[model samples]
Structures are given as C-alpha cells and as structure tokens.
Target: MPRSDSRTRRSRTRSRRGVPLRKSLMVRLLATSVLIAVCSIAATAWLAATTTSHALRQEQGQVLARDAQVYDALLGYAATHRSWDAVAPDVASLAKRTGRRIVLTTPQRRTLADSAAADHAALPAAVSAVVNPLAVDSSLTGGTGATPIDPRAVGPYRLTAAERTALAASARSITGCLLKLGEPSQISYAPSGRPRVTTESLTAAAPVIPDVCGGQSRILTRPTPTEAAALHQLEGLVNPCLRRQGMSPIRIGLDYIGPQSIETLYAPMDAGRITEGCVEDGRREQLAPYVAPSALLFVTGVPGADTTGFALTGANAVRIVEVAALVLTVTVAAAVLMSTRLIRPLRTLTEAAQRPDQARNRVPVSTDDEIGSLAVAFNDLSARRERLEDQRKAMVRDVAHELRTPLSNIRGWLEAVEDGVAVADRPLTSRLLREALLLQHIIDDLRDVAADDAHTFRLHTERVRAAEVVEWVCAAHRDAARTARVALTWSAEGDPELTADALRLRQAVGNLLSNAVRHTPPGGSVEVRTSVRDRSVLIEVADTGSGISDEELPHVFDLFWRSEKSRSRLTGGSGLGLAIVRQLTEAHGGRVTVSSTLGAGSLFTLHLPSAAAPPLRRDPAGAAKDRRER
Candidate 1:
C-alpha cells in the first residue's frame, strides 16, 4: 500500500509540474506577459503607496500647517460672504498658492466655486474642513510641536534694544559656560535682535536645561512688536470664542511673554462642546490675514481606503488594467507570428526528408538563414546520391558486357571442335587459349576494383625515388611498346623521393605507360620523365598518339568508361586499367591528372609528396661570386 501510494504521489507531482507547459506557445507567452505585468503593476502600486504613505507620515507637521492655512482662508471667505457667488477668485487664488485643485460646495453637495472644472467629478464630495469662522475643527488645531505659529511674528514677547543687549550678555555667559564644560556654542541672533546661544547639535536637544550651559539652556528669545500686536488680537478672539462656549474669560499678559507661556494657558483646557469648533475658528481668525492658502488639499490613493493615505481610485485602477491587457495582446501576437514563420520551413523540410528514395524530392531554398542552408545541403546530397545510383547501374551493365565477349569466343571455338565443324588444330587451340587469358585478365581487373571499393586494398609504404619508379615502369613496358611499333623513352631529374607503396606506385605508372604505348600510332613516340615541383615528385607520361578530347577526358577515370563507344573488347580493353590506377594512386595519398589537346597528344602527370627533405643544389657561378665578395 505504501509503495503504491508513493507511486501515485509521484505521478500526481509530475502531472502538476507538466500541466503549465502543455499550453500552446501563444497561451504560454500571453500568460507569462500577463503574469509579469500584473506583478509589476502590483509591485509599483504597492511601492508607490508605501513610499508616499511613509513620506506623508513623516511630514505630518507640514501637512497640518498647510491644512491650517487652507482652513483659515476658507473661514475668512465664509465669514465675509453672505453667499458663495464671489468665491471663485478666492478658490482660484488658494489653488494657485497651494498647487492643488480647489472647490467650494454647499452642505447639500451642490457645486458653488471650483478652481478646476474637470477635476470636479474626480474629487470626493467629503468636506476637508467646515467653512465656519465661529466653529473649531480639531483637524486644523494641532501641530508637530505645540500649535502652528507664524515664525515672522514674535508677538508681545518681541525684544526691545535693552532686552536684546541683556540677552546677548546672557548668551556670552552661556557660551563661556559651555566652553568650560567642553561643549560647543555660538551666539546666534534673530532678525528681531533677540540673541540666542545656539549649537548644531542643540537642534535635537530636549527642552530640559543642560548643566553644561550654566543651567540656562533656552532656545527662544524676546519677540518683536509685530508678534506682540498679533498676540493681543489672538487673545481678544479667544475670549469671544470662550464666552460663546460658556467658559470663563482668560487673561493674557500685556507685558512681553514667550509663546510657550501663552500656549500653556489655552492648549490644556477644552472650555465646552461649542468651543470644540470655536477654538479652531478663533485661532484661524487671528492668523487669517498673515498666511497664504493652498488651491486644493486631500489625500487618497488606495481603493476603499481613507482619504488621508495612499489609495487607488476606481478610474486609476481601470486605466492600469487596460494598459496591462494591451501589453499582453501585443506579446501574444508577436509570439504567434514568429512561431508560424519558423514552423512553415520545418514542415517543408520534414516532408522532403520523408520522400521515397526513387522520388528524389528537394526543397526550395527561399531564405538565407539556417533553415535555408539546411535545405541546400540536403538537395546537394540528394543529387549526389542520384548520380552515384546511376553510375552503379551503368557499371553493372559494363561488367556484364566485358565478360560476355571473351567467354563467347572461348565457348564458340570449343563447340566448333566438339561438333566437328572445325578441327582442333594448333592455330585454333592458340586462339582459344588467348581468349581464356583475356577472360582471366578481365576478372583480375574487376577483383582489384572491387577490393579498392570495399576498403580491403592496402599498401606497404616505403621511400622510393621517382626516377627509379619511372625507369622500372618503362623497362617493364618496353617490349609492349616495341610490339605496338611505338617508340618508348624516359628521363629523370632532381632525384626526387616519395613515401609510397612501391608495387602499387609501379602498377599505377605502368598502366599509364602501357596506355600511352598502346594508343601511339606507328613511329609515334612515348616519353616518361620525372621531376620535382612544389615539394612533390612529378612523373610525366607524354604520348604522341591519338589524344583524348576535352569532353571525354573527365570520364577517363570512371570504371568501365572508354573513349571508344563500340563494345569491342579487343580494341577498347576491359576499360578498368585507368580506373584501377586512379584507385591505387589515391590509396598512396597522391593524385594523377591528365591534359590533352585534339590531334596534339596527351600528358599524364603523377603528383606525390616528397618522403624526405632533399639536399639543396646551388649554382657554381653564384658560389664563386659570393666567395669573391667575401
């Protein structure tokens, strides 16, 4: 059971692994493109949300300040207007200042004023802040450190000349104290002439006094007159908001005081439910004339999420999906197109390859790529195979033709003597014997060709002088040349040596010599000569006989091919001698070439590589000149 279960599990695993790959190339490519696009789009969306969310979270203080400025502007506009008819310029001005699209709508969601008409549909109907100067919104009241204060206005705490001078003396004293304690300090002055002891590291310093600075570590200096006037106006607005909230009036110092002292009075206490909206409005009313407002403000980039964080809206998500679909479509189209082009040629090649042997099928080369080259090579191979098959059939016919004549002559003579048609005389017996000898010669030549073809022929290689081989061949064929009434002569030069099978080399040369002698007419001359050229030994057999024609010369080395078309064996020979010579020469890693001119005779040259380095021969005249110069 366990073994069967394991086998089943393996099969299931294999099936699972193979399921995805069974799809077509178009499906696979489209699926892969869609997968990648989805992943990329998702990753991009996630990364965008994460980065923007973290950045917005870090700039919470800046966001709160911008919100406060916008609210203040809106609140001022609402406080002055009986209706929103003249609010367009205000909305446009705020939008330009804040780099955001701004819109004003009534509580019933009716559009009143808009900075960008096109963006109106896209914008959420949720109000960012209530446009009531009498109301306070908690969203607009808090800041990063204390409440958001205008840095340019110092309020009642603005420093006088005497106060600045006093603060400078104190700063110098603090610097001395810091130096004594091995801390860095510098006296930095505000534009309002308030002096301060500052340090680069002190920006991160806590509010508590450090003993190193003589226990007088303070960051704030006295405020300017502008700040003092602003503070007076803010205190008056706060009392009215407190009164409306049913809270007792609060008193602020007419004398110069730091902002920290003033914030401590109002920030901790919530007067009443009415003041929840009232306090925020009072703060905005005090600072409304000072700060610039933004054009638009809101945050939402994630779907089904809050407006304050990164949220993807419906419209944006749809656009992304459409783009991904387009990418997938293009990818699938390209894959299908390329695969189709590739498969067409492959199909043609397969059909051609599967053709029957007799059909001799070939594919057209239509391109210059790898597939086209493959088609060309296949066609060439087919042509060569067809030619070889034809040659094989012709050779069989020729072999049969050669053997028939000799056998027929021998059989005819013997039957004549036996039947009493002719007497078995000496001349008749000699002719029969000659016919038998001719048959044996033909058989021997066929056997050599067969051995060479079957790779059973071998050579015994040795160093041989070209001149010696030529001399021996000429001597062996001298009698035949005499009998043919042809003059035979030979010469040697350079004493060139070759590594070869001596018997085969001699036989190859003898065939050429015999052919030359046989073909030469009466008084015609046959010459054998040896020389060295191009680091090879050359043996030339030139005959002043009936030379081969240009059209017939190329077929000279083909088996059973002869210049004479007649099937007369006595005149044309067995037609295997030159073919055997070619086989033997090739076995020795050499080649034989012939050149002929009509009525001018022929030259056959055997080219063989030198077996050993030869001694250099120098002219005696050149040697003498060198010696005289020395």
Candidate 2:
C-alpha cells in the first residue's frame, strides 16, 4: 500500500476555499450613493432637455407669427398714403410710433422708402436677389400663353434678413399682379370682417410686371370694414417718414377674417416715378438660415404663413448635447470605479488562499463591508490550517520515532557481526531474527495507515471457539508475565464456543494482552476477561500500570500518536498496535473501547458480533496452538 496525500490535499482545499475579505463600510456607502446620484442626474437631465426644447419651439413660433403680422400691416399703410400729398405726410407717424420698421413699396413692385427697421438693416443677399416682385403670373383663376403661372419658376428669396424683403416683395407682387388701384379687380370682397376674393372683377396684362413681378393682373381681393378700420390703424404710422416725399394718400384693399382675425392690407407704389426715394433694407443675420426655403415664394407667390414650423433654436440643441455628454462621461467613470471596488478584495483573497504554509497564509481583508466578512472567513481558514499542519508534523515525527527503535536494534547487531564484534551464528542469529521480526511489525503498522483509505479491507469470516480463545490468550501471555515477574490473571463467563475467525480473534486479544504487559511494571498485574456485552461478545485486558491521562485518552488509537508522559510511554508498543486492533475489530463489524485513570489501571474492550451458535466441532490441536501463541 502507498501512503495517501490526504494531508496535502486537505491543506490545499482549505487554503483555496477559505480566505477572508475586507472592505470599508464607508467606501461601499459612497459608491452606492454615487451610482444613485449619477443615474438620477442623467434621468432628470434627459427629461428637462426634451421638455425645454419643446417649450422653446412653441414660443419661437408665436414670436415669428407676430413679426409676420407687423409686416403685413406696414404694407397696408404704405399703399394708403401713396395718393394724397396732404394726408400722406400725416400718415408718417404710424411708422415712427410702432418701435419697428416699415417699407413702402410701389404697386409696380418698387420700394418707395422705409421706417427705422428696414432703413438701417442691410438686406440679406438672398433677399437682395429677389428680382421678381410680382410673384404670381396668372389672372383671377388661371392664365394661358406666356402669362400662365409656372409654379416651379420661383424667383430668389430674401432669407438673410428674416425675409422682411420676402414679406414686402410677396405682398407687393401679389397685389400688383392681382388687384387694381381704383378698378374693382377680379377679387370678391367680404363684408363684416369675413374676407374673400372677387375673381369676376379681375383682368390681366402680359410682360409679367418686368423685374418687379412675374406678370400684370388686376384682381380685387374682398375687403372688410373692420379690415378698413385695421387699415385706418396704419394711417398715423407712415406719414412721419413719408410726408417730405410728396407721395399721395393711396387707395388700399384690406382683408380680414373674424373681428380679431389677422388682416392683410395692400397699398401701391410707383417707385420709378417717386419724387423722393422710398427704400427698404433688412437685418442680414436673421434671414441667412432660411435662404433655401424662402426662395420658394416668387413662382408660388407668398404662402400664407402662420409661423408654420416649430422653431427649436440651435443653441438649445447644443446645450442638450453638452449636458448629455457630461452625464455619459460620469456614468462610465462610475461603473469602472464600481467594478474595481467590487473586485479588488476578491483578488486579494484568491492570492492569499493559494498559499501552502499555514504560518504564511493570511488575507489582508480588513474592511468593514462585505470584504470584511471575507476577512473573518480567512481568519477561520488560517486557524484550521494551523491545526492540520500541526497534526501532520506531529504524525511524521512520532511515526519516525516508533519505527527507528526496532530498526536500530536490527541494524546495530548486524553491524557488530560485520565488524567481528559479535558472532553471527546460533543464538546471535536467532536474536537478530527476532529483532528483524519486530522491525517487520513496525513496517506493517505503517502499512496499515497507508492502506486505511484503500478499498481492499475485508474479513475472512469463519467459525471458531470464542471463550476458549480468551482463556488461551491469558495462558499464553502468562509465560511472558512470568518472565517480567508480573502476575497474569484470567476470568471468563458464558464459556461457549462461538463463531469467529480463530486467527483475527486471537490477534485482537493478543494485542490487548501485549499492551497490558508492556505498560505494567515488573510487579504489576495483567488481567484478561471475556463476556457478552449486550448482543456481542466482549474481550478485555486491564492493567495496573500508568493509565492514560483524560486529555490523551481520546487520541490513543491515532496512528503514531504517543504521550511518553502518559500510559503509552511505558506500554512499549508501537502506538499503531491499538489502531490496528481497532481496525481488525471493525472489519468484523465489531467495536473496541478503553477506560483509564492517570496512575492506576486501564481497561481496553473489544465487542465482537455474537454468533448464532457455537461451533459443533473444533480442532483441539490447531486451536491449542493458536491459544498457546496468543
């Protein structure tokens, strides 16, 4: 049998499986807080960005529509004052009091002049490029020949200046091509503020109004009294800026819907024949972005815009992007740190656990968190490692000590004979042979420990005398007791010939007898007894020798365990003797027990499985040989 590596295997398992962890409580709490805070901030920022963009676009649209309204009114004022030189001068105040700008364009689609806003602001390039002032080329319903409206042939648009020019050019061009100054054109008027077109009263002229318009048409748009009142509201505004020009009070058409509905008013301008110039300009910054879409007007005329699109500003989008980027950066950093904090302690525990030496194995998990709990576990592992380590070292030291004595005796005498110090013949040879046999017993004891884990252990069951075997062991050891000058006593009850293995049964009893003789002093006594305890046969050997200490009693049968200060020291038997006895007994489905006092006597007990019946016949001579050798 080969020795098992149980100690090493057990050590490795303990080391690898049991390391403590250490993490700080405060650190864990802070990490948790950071995770929660970052998520909350990110969520809130997303919601805020979405909602704020929506609200800003809503507000910007309203502002754009209001601006469009002002443009519409200014065109009305300019046309109304173009006819009467007397009343035209008075209408200039309307432009000055509005805190805004105005453009007076001719019916021929020429800019007559401007109030503050247009005069100071430079026209956007896209607006400057809008040469087709009469944006529509058709008559009331449709047109044929060269005057047929081609909706795809839209002219340039004034986008850079927020299309102030688009407003002027759209109204000027549309009214010039579709309406007349004094003749009721094709447009049908609506009364009581409900505006509509009077298509029957319209006519057309070709040559599409030169560069100022796409064509010339006279379509009267339906005007209302409230629209006339809305036009009257413009009377006081245009004169302050236009009176010096000697322009006349002009006839204008106004369209209105609902009392509070928005109105569009139109006036005519003869820019080429004006006594003094009327000019319009615009802010470049406001119109640059819309250049492409605003250019869609001339071929299609002015679309009735009511701030048609939601205007979410670029600045608002930029802000949201910046905020989102910050949140993403913070979240990534937190996740990295969190994973690190979580994994650090476990790595330390792993390294510590891989160590082999009990003294060298320790985990540095001194934390107040989950890692701390791991630290505690590591401490437990360390203690267990220490215990097993001590047991291994002790077994090695004791086993060597037990084997050396008998081995040395054989080796010493053989060396003496080789040196011619002692004769290697007869009695000397017999003494050497006896010493060799004792050494062989020690080797066999070691083999038992080695084979303990193997699966080959089995008993050869047979029937033999039981009570007679006990009696015979006592008699056999009596000669050895006489040699030691120790009295050997024997007793038996229920003297029946029971079923048992003659050899193994004798071996268990002989071991107990030898243990008794080994521990007893020269004058001390050895006693062997047999009885049935409960259902099993019992054989015992008690000795008046230095008995086992209470503390060492439990470990008496451990392989190679010994306490020279206790009973096993004087027993002079390899400690494995009792261990082997126990093994053989258990192989027969039996048990062994022991009791002792420190300085008085000790009792060793073996309980064998009882046989159903005693042997009917037994070999007297063979049984006597076994009993005599007991």
Candidate 3:
C-alpha cells in the first residue's frame, strides 16, 4: 500500500472508535436537559412543601380557635338552660361552622346532642372536654387563676328588666361625669345586665377614677335591687362556711375587681384564700339547679391529627413521581429534537465535503442560521473552482492550438529546404524569423502571466504622464491602422501623471491599441483618450469595430479567450493580449474594464492611481511679452 493510503486508513480507524457518551453533543444536550428538569421539579416541590406547611399551620391555628369558640358557645348554653332539649340545633350549627363533629353526652354516656347523629357515627374514644356550668374548663374559657365556675352562670343573680333599666341610667350618669372631667369612658353591660364604666386604657389592676368621678363609681358599683337580693342570699350561703373555717364573715359584692378587694378586709393570706374557696363553693351550690348537668364533650375531625408532623400521603407521592417523570421525558425529547436539527446540517456539510467532485457536490440550505451561511460560502467556493477548472482545460487547448500552427509551418519549411524543394533565401528567412518572433512573443506573454500568478512580477514605479503613454501606444499602432485602412486618433484632457512602471503602462496600452486596430474595419476609427478622474488617471481606448456580444464581453479578458473562436491564429492573434493587459494593470495596483454593445463600438478603460504633477517652469521673456500685451 502507498504510504499516504496507509496513513489515511489508520486515521479512519481512529475516528471510527467514536466519542464517549459524555463528549457527544447529543448526549451532553440530553443530560443537560434532564438535569435542568430535575432541578426545576425539585425547586417547585420545595416551594410547594414550604407553602403547604405554612398554610397547614395557619389552618391548625384556626381549628384551635374554632374549637375554643364551640366550647364557649356550649358552656354559655349550659350556663343558661336547665336541660339539653333544644341543644341539637346548636350542636349542628357549631359542627357546620367549624367543619367538625360535635357530640354531647351525659356523665352516664347517654347521648344528649350529636351533630353527626344522622350518620350514626361512633364517638371517639377520647373526650375533648367536660361541659359543666358549675365547674367550667378555664383553659377552654380563657380564664386563669380564677373561679372554675363560669361567670355567665348568674342563676338567681340574673337582673330583672326594671332594675336593669334603673342601673343603666346610673351607669350613663357615671360615664357622662367621667367624660366631663376629661376622661373618655364607655359603658359595658355584663351578662347580668349590670353596666360597668371602663376606658380603653383601663386595666384590671388600675381603674381610672377621678376625684369627681369617685362618687359616681360608688353609685354605679352599688348592687341593683335584684342583685342586692341575690347578693344577700349568696352572703347567707357563704357566711356559714366562712364561720366554720374560723374566718370573719364578709360582705359579698356582685363583682370581684382583684386581690385588693380581699386586702381591704385586713384578712390574713390563709383567711383570704379560705374566704375565696368558700365563696366559690357557695356560688356553685346556689347556681347548680339553674344550669345543665355536666356532660362529656366529644370533638372529632380536627386538623393535624397525626402528631408526628406533616408528611406526603401515598397518592401525593405517586403524583409527584409521575409529574417528575413527565417533565424529564419532555425535556429529553425536546433536547433530542434540537440536537438533531443542529447536527443534521453539519452532517450534510460533511457528506458533501467528502465527495470527490467538490465543484458539483452542493448541500441544500434550508435555514437562515450559521449552517446556512456556511453552506452558501461552500457553494460559492465550489462555483469558483468549477470556473477555474473550465479555464484550465480551455488554456491547455488554446496553448496547444496556438503553438501547433507555427511549429508545423516551421517544421515543413525546414524539411522542404533540406530536401532541395525550397531555397534558404532572404524572403523565406524573413518569414521564418517572423514566425520565430511570434513564438517568442507568445512565450514572453506566457512568462509574464506566470510571473504575475506566482507573485514574482516586480514594478520599478516612478511618476509617468498618462498622455505620454497613450501617445506612445497610439503611435506604435498608427502604421497598422493605416495599412488596415483604419483611422487612429488620440486625445488628452490634461497632462495626467501617475505613479507606475512606464514600460508596463506602455505595454498595457499598446495591447489595447493593437486589439482595437486589428478589430476595427477599414475606414473605422480607433481613438485613444486620457483624462484625470478623482485621484486616478483614466486611459480609455474606444474603437468603432465589430463590438463584442453580451455573452462574450465578460470573458474578454480571460486567459486565451477569443471572441471569434474559429478564427485562425494569424487573423485573431494569440488571444493573450487583453489578458496580459488586465494582469499588468492589476500588478500596478489598478484595474482595466471593458464595455461593449453588439453592432456598436467597444471601450476599454485603465484606472490607475494619480500622482502630483511637477511644477511648470515660467519663461521670463514670454511673461514680459504677455504682460506688455495685457
């Protein structure tokens, strides 16, 4: 095998080993998408868990508050009623409001009122609380370090309507007096219909009592007629207990402000405690019959039943897993779609690039992305390669055709002279020398073209006049134009100067003039013109000849190209003149352009960089004569 082939085979083998999954674009994209999806799901789950925990805690607080409300309502109901006959409606209302099952039963477990009685549900094993007006649950009632008996259990102390109205008027009088004394106060009636004077800033330990309002307080704080009667009965019940405990009998009031009320009695601490105990016992005994019997209260369906804290249930767990799986699947599928779209164009480019015929192999451009731009650039490169290939083949044929005729003629003439069929005379020698010079001319042109192509063509640049170059080229072609019966003329707009090789400039313009004279018919005019334009000098050669066709105009300056493809070498010339003109013009950092129309004349323009003109010398005698004439 060839060394290059073996190396290529080894390289192909290495490439076929393939990339690892981690390095592949598709695999990386898939993994990245999955990672993003998992992160998103995890973040969403964390937020949901946090939010749900907060909401459940708030709900737990609401449940406890509602439970307290239910207990307070039932305690009030039992404090007023002697039985549970109308208590079923209240239980149902509490259950509906709190979204819980409330059940009330006697001490003997006999059902009193059950909100869920219609469903016949079994009661919970534990009781929430005990409902008793004589001994209330202070935790449920929000009372602390006070009597267990509910304050609402007034019983015989409940004020009559007539006494309540009379006491309300007294309460108003006290409130008005406090207001006049610059003390803002409001009137509040307790469950017993006894009005109390208080202010927003009032605390139980420190009551607001102005000097002028002290008498009003005394009047309002005094028991009403109905309360007085109840107080006398309560005192009668309490004094006996106090006497038995060796404590002095005390006058009982309708309300107890604080421990200060007991301090006023000058009673010892033990005596004060015993007095409070005795008062509670006597009050319970007095109000026992007017309230409901003690019952066992059962509340069910409260939130946060499992005391181990929050946890996701089986269904919720399954749903979360399903959602995570769906997200991952969707993300991976989308990644695959995007990666395929991205890699497909690259694959097409690879396949097209690998084809042997690059000039013909083209990839389709479907998107306006980077891949599309790459494909467009590749297509342009292919087109340029194709044009160069055509030009290469045509150059080979034209060179062969151009050299073959002269060689054949020279060979035939030498053979004839050697065979004694022709003389080696001056005319024949002249013909032979002309043919040899033509060959040398063609070789020289080819050498120049090769040097330019290799970037070895050097220019000895200097300031030269464009008009002088045009005149030289026109003068050289004047004899040929006259012999062909063609009129040659030359003109200049100004003495335009340019920085270039004078010899190369003459050669370029000479080529154009020669082409113009040869192509112009007899009595046709060939014109050479020079003018300065902007920072460049324009050398134009316009000829009234058989103009080039639109299709052939573009390739006029192409190597070895001729408008008359079938014309002989003698008639059409070597076809390298215009091409050399272009190469020489471009070597000078300039350009040559040709424009022609069918049946009309052709124009060739050389655009070269302009140079500053030298200063003109003034003639002293001519200046004196011109001044005298003025």
Per-model C-alpha lDDT, please? 0.66, 0.53, 0.75
Instruction: Give the per-residue lDDT digits (tens) of candidate 1, residues 357-382.
Output: 85567777665445555666676556
Provide the lowest-lDDT 10-residue window in model 3.
Answer: 258-267
Best by TM-score: 3
- Candidate 1 — worst ten consecutive residues by lDDT sum? 621-630
Distance (Å) between predicted and true CA of 310, model 3?
Answer: 3.4
Per-prediction tally of clashes:
22, 64, 0
Where does candidate 3 stray beyond 4 Å? 1-309, 613-630
Residue range 1-630, candidate 3, lDDT tens digits = 457346434433434555455556557566777887777778578757765676577667777788888899999999899998899999999999987889899888899998877778777788889999778778776777356777777788787998788778866777787678677877776677766666666622214453466555565555677767777887888899989988779886634242222112122334568887887788888888889989989888734345435556565566667766766777778778887988899999889888847547767766554555566666655554665677778789888888887888899899999999999999999999988888889899999877766657778988888888888888788788999999999999978888889999899999898888888888899999999887778999999999999878867887787877784765688988998897777767677888998777899999887886432223434432222221
How good is model 3 by TM-score? 0.55
Query: Model 2, residue 27: what's the lDDT?
Result: 59
Better of 2 and 3 by lDDT: 3
